[model samples]
Target: MTDLKPRKMDFGFDDADVPFLWNPENPAWSSMSNAVSFLAVGFEKMIVKLIRQAKPLMTDPAVAEEAVAFMRQEGHHSTAHRQHVAALIRRYPGLQNTLDAVIGEYDLLTEATSINYRLAYTADLEATFTPVFKLMLDNEETLFRPGDDRVASLFLWHFVEEVEHRSSALILYKAVVGSELYRMRMAPSVFAHVLKVIRIACAGFNQHVPLGERKVDALSMFARHRAKQRVLTFFAPYLSKGPMPRAFDGLPIGEQLTALKGAALSQTPGHDPAHENLPVLADEWFRRYDAGDDCTRWYTAEPAASGANR
Candidate 1:
């Protein structure tokens, strides 16, 4: 095995200046999806802070630093997505009610637990998000990785950042509880809430959109943009991989179990940005949902498949 090297952590970046958004012509329903993602992330940042303090007591200083870096990247994401959602809200005035619905779920999630529970939440979240994180990069590889320009740069910007600080919460969880059980136990909890929010936002998709003279059809909207291809391409790598990544890796189980299948997946076999719940602000659609989740228990122990497929 290659020796694990401590990675440098930094939140400082030019992406701070990147325009708050893209895909401006995207439908209002898309904005709602963005809002949900942003909301999930914003809430998760709180949990990030919790894990940092716990990390040092359990692991080495290097791990603590990584936790902070992970938190910072998530923080940056939160700010960017917040701005993205605000811009969309401005453009589509009538989308307020559905926007509130997404936020409402976020509120409920926030109020659901204590700091410890929240830490448990991130531990759970890591189980949920880690795989998706990998899949996102895998999907982007065709478009972004292995290139020389800034565009390619941004792909790893998110990905390298993901790799560099991936273990923050997991290390802490081992120190605190020292359990292999954290990974499995937390997955369902995280999925339940996340799925609920997604279901509401997806269903409310049409309500947020503005149709001039014609209403948007969900099926047609999904078909228009190579959405199916994007999904299948990214997920194919996951399905084809010979064995599951061990839970010890701090990879989210969500990455393992889903291509976003039941986390409220919708097929717009014929959709496009203008008529679908496609993310208007992809950044926002991804970040704002984790409200103080805790992943401290995620990386502590190996799974039963000893050294199988890591």
Candidate 2:
């Protein structure tokens, strides 16, 4: 049994992650959904980076098999997410510049080729995403809300996948670069972004969108799905992921990843949506995402015909 466990499952985004497509019903959601395309461009880059790193580490035949599975799942995740972002782009034409700018920033950062910089970038991203997952775990029931299902699926699936492979890159980072400061730097940034995205999305927006506007009460919606709870929920188990000062045993990154992946596979559900979908989304993902059998092409997104549809 692998020592690694699947982190708590959760939805990462709040009402802000969901867009209303210009429906006067909830403007913040629309803004959030649209603005998130910029967020996802960075997320996609991170996905690609992990893929590149995983390639060489996957030398052992069995470990290599797991690495391939991880790739496929991530590829599907990126594809599904990009498609969802495409939906948002169709609705908010103005988001193009935002998406491009974020991508450009990634290009600029990666051009330098500093592993520290890349690790920092990865840390920042993990920090950014932590809250979204935290939220999903905190409010497992709220995620089933009728209107938010699609957006919840988007955020939650990503959230779960993050936890499923939570230890992989961190282990890899430590293996390649030998930096504990990286972990310290990453922990704080993770807390920061998770808090900010929620505060702005839920609290700030709720003040603007009144209660009488929708079928369901908007305030309750905000309260139930806020990011604070989500973030906390995710970090709970890791409170003991290691002793207060983690034991530095010099474990091989590949072996640790394989163990974690194997454990995750035991816990998670089937990968293909066509098959019986798994109940635990992220664990399943981290386990089988890289399976060579499932990897597919990620296409450049094109705008939908109507701004209202996305």
Candidate 3:
């Protein structure tokens, strides 16, 4: 049986006044995570279409089942993220253009790319989530706890679920395409496209959101951007993006390096996401969720208040 379960969540993004800087303590993290919300919507929309196209080609019953469940999960994620993005757009209407542009990139890819190439793209990107999400989940106290409860809870649910089905995309890819070399060959382009989408979202943030609200450059998450900004500050201040701060400067450098190494290894041949180290928070989140905790308000929910709906 497929272990992936699609959990429906309403983060009350519409009811509350969602701030652009949701985590005032870490505006850069808030900005970066907002970009992630934008990326998730477009990327998961592509996943839904990709899986639908691949469904008929899936000969193995198990792989078919996994694909169906994975598709359902991703569909729910896309819906939830759309809500988040809608809230942001309600606040900053110009972001609608940004969302359209991001989705347009994936739409173009679907039209231009082959099924095998799309499968490889999905597999290559999803394989890195186990390690990348672990680094964030492991430091949830700093990365999530201080953020707006709704936004923080949204990411907590999303990341844990990403970890839960970490291997699904690769399994589907291997079942259909079955070319490790092809997957590896596609990694660079897949990641480049991902980064490009993120850049679009960040640049939109800078253009649409005022510096007084965002407090730092939206592109601060990129190390290369920071390096370039540092040189510009010394040489050409007029061309610099304002106040390049990192989303993860508080995180341990070793943990960050480990995540980077793990991400690199994930693209190589014969890498199994099932064998990757998991975050302790994923297990705890599952336990709480299974126990009927109100995960939509992860921090405020009382654990002792049992029998609440998931």
TM-score of 2: 0.48
The C-alpha stretches of model 3 lying farther than 4 A from their native spots are 235-240, 307-310
TM-score ranking from best to worst?
3, 1, 2
In order, candidate lDDTs are 0.41, 0.42, 0.93
Quote the lDDT for 102 in model 3.
98
Tens digit of lDDT per residue, candidate 3, span 1-310? 7899899999999898899999998888999999999999999999999999999999999999999999999999999999999999998999999999999999999999999999999999999998999999999999899889999999999999999999999999999999898898888899999999999999999999988899998998888888878888888787766788788889999999999999999999989999999999998899889888888999998874665433
Q: What global local distance difference test value does model 1 have?
A: 0.41
RMSD to the true structure for each prediction, in A, is: 16.1, 15.0, 1.9
Model 3's lDDT to the true fold?
A: 0.93
Q: Which stretches of candidate 2 lie over 4 Å from their true place?
A: 1-37, 57-69, 127-132, 183-310
Cα RMSD of predicted structure 2: 15.0
**How do these models rank on lDDT, best leading?**
3, 2, 1
RMSD of 3: 1.9
Return whichever of 1 and 3 wins on TM-score. 3
